[model samples]
Target: MKSSLFKISVLIGIFSIVIYACKDKDNNEKLEETVLQGTATIYVDQTLQPIVEDQTAVFESQYNVKLNLVNQSESEVVNALLTDKTQIAVLSRKLTKEEENHFNQKKIIPKITHFASDAIVFITNKASQDTLIDLQEVLNLLQEKESKIKALVFENPNSSIVSYMNNLAGVKNGQKKNIYSLNSHKEVLEYVSNNQGSIGVIGLNLLVQPFEDTKQYTDKIAVMSVRNVKSQPNNVLYYKPNQSNLGEGLYPLKRPIYMLNYQGTAGLGMGFASFVAGDIGQRIILKSGLLPVRIPSRELNIRKEIINNK
Candidate 1:
């Protein structure tokens, strides 16, 4: 009887150990797979804030999730991701090789999803007679060559627009004398609207959906159509950063928008990334005046009988 009791106690101990192990495994799985119902913080490029806010609103309403968005300059966004401040970042450009190396050293591979196409637009005061700008002229201004515009105003020195223009113009060091960096896009708009001969460089998203306080300032400014210098045969077509122009690649200053997820697990970051690349998120992009990565499908009904014209 003593031996049998000892055997029963051993069996109970083994069963309890097995149960505990299984429970721990289940808990880990739950933590890894909780995609639609958790809290996540995302760093977003300030220029893309308007459209991203729209996406987060619908996503949070549909799922039991909370998204905290930190809108900063593109450089700050990249810095936050590299420093592990956030696992997800929305940017106009992909990570550079050096940036990827940082993640490689940490054994973290980022998942990048291209969601939409955005544009860098130039705006001036409505009273300005120059309604059209040549792409080459803008580059010349960046290169410190003589140009029609007196100065170029940008939101932030570290913003993506400034970086893009600098790379495009092949500027090695500081910006040209004519280029100026302000605190925010609003200031750029206001500065351009009040000062003639100065042009504001801003994201098309702001013009599409301006804030209530800045609506009047938007009206006071004019969006200039850009003449593409890269077109073959010296094409004379000028295009504005409208939906159709951006979709057809006619816009001269177009950039791709991407969502980079470094969560390395099936969490809310993954879920939000999927949501942005999915059908509904594309629709949101369409409504926000930017070109969706994939055009949403439309179903049309056909009738055999033709209706009489009224």
Candidate 2:
């Protein structure tokens, strides 16, 4: 009787251990399999917020996911990603070597994917008669040299546009007295619209496809045509920030937008990143007036016979 009782007790202990192990395995499997469902926070450059918002809206509606998009300056976005505050970020530029090295130390390989092309556009008040701007003159303005521009307004001091223009003009520190930095892109538009002789530097996405909130100001501002400084004096060509110009590489202020995913797991970040790079997301980009990384194809059927009746 004593031996039988001991055997029964051992079997019960083994069964409990097996059951606990199976439960733990099941929980892990569920966590690993959840791709399109979960919460993810994505930090996006302020300049590209309009388009990113559009992408997020569609993505959230299509899947059981909640995307918290934090619109911030370029520097802030990079900081968030490096600090692990957020696992995903959208920016006009890719991560620097030092940034990638930091991730390498942690055994994480970031997935950077280019999704679209954007342009930096210059806008002025409608009252201004100067409908065209010379690229050299713009560079000269950035360099604090005398130029045709009276004043320049930027979205933010730390924005990608400011960095891009500074690099282009070879400006190490400080800016011209006439140059100014505001809090947001909308403020830039409002200031330019209300104040004459002020040229606003903004992203092309807002002007090309204005959102409801920005349409009022965008309607009041006039987009200026930019002349390429590299072009010969006699062969200088001015291009506008349109889809055709961006697609043909005629726009000199064009920049590529990239999505960086550092989730390091099959989480919602991976799913959202895939969605943005997939067909539906590219179509949203195409409709937003930005140049999608991959142009969605269209099929058309042609009839061999044409009937003309008068």
Candidate 3:
């Protein structure tokens, strides 16, 4: 009977070990990721930092998740993604074909979520009398051709705005003598504010929603309305970068903002992308003065009977 008891005890210990092993296996299968729960690092284009910060604040407050956003220049963000430093990024434009093929070679599928429409804005010192600029003049100035623009200040050469303007002007780079690049958008705005006849090219998000420290800089600058001179000359009209103009496709310098996920699993990247493309996220974008991909729906209540008050 003692021998039998010893054998039974050995069997029970083995069974317990097997159970614990299976539990460990199950836990390993799940990476602790769910729709509203997980930790993620998101790389955002520095120009879009303000708007994204608004989205992340609301997202974390309502969900059991923590998001760490690394805001850098557009090139830096893309380079980080390519080098496998990160799997999530937000940019003003979608990934190019070459960038997509890099992941394709690695058999990693990318999820691109276009959430909002953002505008590239031209700002000038409030003291300047020029309130509007023609698209041709801007392009010509970028091409190193003489134009009415005295000086064009912008973010660094690697920034998305510089690329957008260069692409518009059909140039590889902005080598114009009058073109100047600063370390950041804040610096560009400050320079424009302090200098006369300097147009600061910046993202609309910065001007529309100013942070506490940047409010003074924004207060001293004015958005320069842009006229699309390439289109019908007689019917040309100047447009300010605003939600209405972006939604109507009337804004001359606008781009789609995309959330790119290459995490390859149903991870935090997926959750944040869905959130930004969802109703609540869209509402935040709307409140941020940009155009959301889908305007969040509204519900109204109607009263059929009214009571009179004495």
Off by over 4 Å in 2: 1-33, 173-175, 302-310
Tens digits of per-residue lDDT for model 3, 1-310: 9999999999999999999999999778754776678778999999999989999999999988899999999999999999988999999887889988879998998888999988889998899898898989988888878788777888888999998888888899745688888898878888988987788898888788877878888888889989976569686689999888888888789898999999898888888889899999999999889899999999998989888896
Task: Tell me, by TM-score, which candidate is best.
Answer: 3
Worst 10 residues of 1 by lDDT: 26-35
Q: Pick the candidate with the highest lDDT.
A: 1
Clashing pairs in 3: none
The alpha-carbon lDDT assigned to residue 51 of candidate 1 equals: 96
Candidate 2 residue 83 C-alpha distance from true site, Å: 1.3
The TM-score, computed over Cα atoms with residue i paired to residue i, of candidate 1 is: 0.86
Question: What local distance difference test score does each model get?
Answer: 0.89, 0.87, 0.88
Per-prediction TM-score = 0.86, 0.85, 0.88
Off by over 4 Å in 1: 1-33, 232-234, 303-310
What are the clash counts of all predictions, listed in order? 0, 0, 0
Error of 2 at 188 (Å): 0.9
